[model samples]
Target chain A: MRPSSAERASSGSFELFAWLFMRISGVILLGMAVFHLFYMHFVFGVERMNFNTIGARWQNPLWRVFDFFLLAFALFHGFNGLRVVLDDYLSQRPGWRVLAKTLVFVLVVGLMSIGGYVIFTFPAAANLAAVP
Target chain B: MKAHFKIKRFNPEKDREPHWEEYELEVEPTERVLDALQTIKWEQDGTLTLRRSCAHGICGSDAMVINGKNRLACKTLIKDLGSHITVEPLRGLPVIKDLIIDFTDFFAKYRSIKPYFINDEPPPDVERRQSPRQRARFDDTTKCILCGICTTACPVFWADSRYLGPAAIVQAHRFLFDSRDQGAEERLPVLSAHGGVWKCRTVFNCTDACPQGIDVTGAIAEVKKLLLFRKL
Candidate 1:
């Protein structure tokens, strides 16, 4: 028998979108992550990444947006992959699967919110004296 | 050459759990594992049990774990497997007896894909026709023999039985890519469902396990691509 409308609605195209997001976000993440590390480590210099440097970079909204997307895509891509892992390992254990998935969901949301807030709302200008 | 055969055995009536039984046999290097098994059953132990038909590997009835790999016993040459050979039933399925697994779920998954032609426009003067290119698109998946090796070899299917498994996706690909098959609309939803193509992790065990060299994992990726872009 076909599933009811409500039941079908729950599973509708979410996995498809999730699967696509992994591939797309994976590519985006690859470029963003490599550029991030290269820019920070080589051009910007790891030693120069003090609070004042970050404060200066965040003065530009584009940097904040880039950081936000970096955080979001990495989190979604990673947690969705984790969800697949949970589905694989905990399949025989229903209660644990639900609890673990819920925990991962909470972590993704909580971390995204925290990371987004930090990226967008951190003090735009750091007191130069505080760096030392 | 003298070979040591270690077979996993279980008797539901007498044994609570499966155990290993070993036999020593002299055999030619060119002889297949099936020959070694026949010698063991015929000369050493009559109770040794296995399923085989068309003993040349086309029937796909004798898929088992030979030397820790999924292979057709009839096709695996004893020379390839070292002196110590271990034969076990295909993993992730209930072993009905020694070297025989229950294929009820495996075949059911195959049938769930609607593995037949489904064009409904009906009655070309003779039969539906297709160009060579179109026929070649799905020719790789046409070699599937419904052997449980590919499905049982899949880690996803081993972990979750609900996952349609690689064999099912390959079967679906056989029809879904057919230019004459109207079943894509029917099969795509089943392939993209929760435990459908999405469950494939692309570990490539199915491709490695396939006796027919069906490119099982590649077929699954094709199905996923079709579902994603809705293009050929």
Candidate 2:
């Protein structure tokens, strides 16, 4: 007899999520990258970009929000891209695939955790004097 | 050299449980694993079942898991393997019997990507000339022999069979990057969709297992970059 839908659902569908994440993240990265290029290169002249300028920019809540968005999207897009590559090339054995992907997940999580912490707690104005 | 082979055996009609059968054979150092298998089948066990053709690595028909790695039996030398060998069917595929795995699902995903050129223009009376550099762009992708080594070596396929796997994506890449092929627009969405190229995790196993030495991960990465940065 065929299994019910619930049984299949309960089996877990993480691949579906990963596939969806790639498309969504790819779209978001597109916007974020363009905006980043525009603001950093076009709006703020290259010559004016010193430590002080960056410090002053971060002092504003809006800039902090913008930087955070860039950081999150870029990291996720890179991690997802790496995941796809791993799936394509890694050994097919269940044990080996699980072990390798687990390692990748742990490393990505670790990097993201450190980056998120730094972004959230970054001192906005303390480095103003050092910026020049 | 004399070596022992421990082969996994299963018969749905005769046996309810799988078992291992050992065969000892005298073989030359340079003789391939397929040679030893042939020796056993001809001289010792006629009922021993397996699949092989061409006796070379080109056909991709002899792929199996040997010493915990996916490889073509026709290409692996017994001397390089060691005193004993463990041979089994490729993983992530349905087992039809002792060594043959059903390839229906594997080929189905292969065909889903529309593995052919799709140009709207009619064929010219004369052959279409391509620049040497343009032809170089697709040179590596054209080497794929439809070998399941990369697909069976992939972790994504093991976890999710629905994934198009590395081989199919690499095949899709063959056409996607070809200058003569104008279906990149239509192929990109399908290749980047669910169970498509995006599902691959770049572990480099496909690159390692590919008997043709094709850069499988590199092809997948190029596809991802195209989908991400290129419009449509």
Candidate 3:
């Protein structure tokens, strides 16, 4: 549908920042993913998989923080991409658009919170339990 | 075939508001929308107003919103659109009369892109030579005929007049990618603004609406990539 001339000037920096963030975050995510892929497949290989390997990797806080950043950025990036898709298809349907927006928001928040807590706190929890 | 052409008519001098007037006409299935419009004006109503230079698709003066899509009136067949046809001026422009919208705002954005060549260096005695690959880079965007269909179909342009609509961006892409052009740096800052190429969400409406089959979305993406990488 067409918008009248007077309604055309919706100016704000928020959408501009979002657009910039998408390009920057996309580049960062690409680097992070390629690094992870090389480390897992070529450097260590899949045959090294075991609970002990996981326990050894989490001993360092840096790796834990790296995984946390990866999880958070990837989840938000994916859902924001979905937001564009939802708007393109469901913008005309107000009710359905609201439902879709709510669902994506909940999923992003839930995944980030759960991933953050486990990634950042599991190492501390293990140390506390080891005291006994 | 018998068909009802529902045209949105408005004249500032005569009508207080735009109205849809249906003209019943007998047109062949293969007859173009332009032909149907001609029937209405020639036989039924002499005062019907529209702009069309070439009856074929080359001129691009008869772009209108037909059955919810922006298309070249000379190109769309009546049979393909079925009997019931709705013709309105292109969206996001001031309608002056029946099927003719003002292009002043559109051309302003185009002029802002500096559509002409802006290289400061001296040219050779012959053509400033460009390899086939260099020409191929911007070939798709050069086909734009200033139809305004792609611009009107763009939702971003509809929401923000400040946004340099798809047509303008495609025009910029043409020069930015040309090997002989040295004005990319000058044009880059202009397009780097908030309402620049960043506004494109790649919803594909502009590409779908282009009558010349130009890959409008792809050109936009190329411009974005050029901005991100600073290669152009």
Candidate 4:
């Protein structure tokens, strides 16, 4: 392998983007989380958060989009933090690292699909009850 | 006592690829890993080649991959390593032959950090006086003896040989915190360049690999913190 210092520094945008993502998304997630907590706890109050209120809010696609971004960002931040551990320990074993990464990818895909389906198809309960 | 050693060997002049050779040997409980290698080279086989200087761990010349960890052969007791030992050249650099590795890239990175005391002041009759507290600032880093174990064991350096590895950061820390040195400001941007302190993933592999027990990771963190606050 060509061991030039100049080449590798320029070839590392993936790592650069990952580093920037953590810091920027952390700031964004903090604001979003604070706004969410205020809306849930102070503005609406805990007692008012019944299924009716949540279901009414879920009727808006904007709310779904908001929750989607929150889930995506939070998951990315937490998983990228876990990547530090994997990079340290698992990289020593190439085969194990590959398996670990594949499992993590599958888990993220499954969780995102399930969460998106639940948020978008809330009214599917009505169709289930009338099917019989 | 007896221990099994599996050493990675490659003779570039004769062999096309590297391979491992296993040897069973008798040893004393207090014998260092360097003594074990000496036995192998003197009695078992003369073709084995490795580097060792002080044989007491002070010279830092005998650092190698032992049991998948970077350590000084003269410091590691055979008893502490258990009955099995896997010896190999330090990773991340090209191996020259047997257990010796080419340290050109490692030393180049160290040089990039300017691992020397630098001052532009005119000399007085006496030496540059340093307070006890001022000397303590970079004390942990001063113990480094230019061993490439930390740099070679680094997985980031293994992935991209270009990245200035942890040893370079420790050297930078030494000069960066020196009260008599007038090069901290100059060294700051040099370290902050393309493959600077930002590349550290904080795996702490460097900290783990240091034979001198220096907190290499902590020094790198302090450097990264300087990037924001610009303090000593």
Best by TM-score: 1
lDDT measured at residue B214 in model 3 versus the true structure, 0 to 100: 97
**Residue pairs whose backbone atoms clash in candidate 3:** none
lDDT of 1 by residue, A1-132 (tens): 122345345776877888888989999999999999999999999998987888888888999999999999999999999999998889789799999999999999999999998897776664545545
Using DockQ as the yardstick, the better of models 2 and 4 is: 4
Superposed by TM-score, candidate 4 places the C-alpha of residue A55 at a distance from the truth, in angstroms, of 11
- What tens-digit string does per-residue lDDT give for candidate 2 at B61-167? 88888888888999999889996999988888878888888988888877777799888998899877789998999789899988698999987788777577888
Model 4, position B34, has a per-residue lDDT of: 94
DockQ of each: 0.40, 0.07, 0.08, 0.10
- B167-199 per-residue lDDT for model 3 (tens digits): 999999999999889888767765766457777
Per-residue alpha-carbon lDDT of model 4 for B144-205, expressed as tens digits?
A: 98879888877777765546888888999988888899888667665665466766878888
> lDDT per model, in order?
0.87, 0.79, 0.83, 0.81
Candidate 1 lDDT over residue span B11-95, tens digit each: 7778888999999989999999999999999999999889999999889999999999999999999999889999999998888
- Candidate 3: global Cα-lDDT? 0.83
- How would the docking of model 1 be graded? acceptable
Please give each candidate's TM-score. Answer: 0.93, 0.68, 0.70, 0.72
Off by over 4 Å in 2: A1-132
Pick the winner on DockQ between candidates 1 and 3.
1
Query: Of the native A-B interface contacts, what share survives in model 4?
Result: 0.02
Best by DockQ: 1
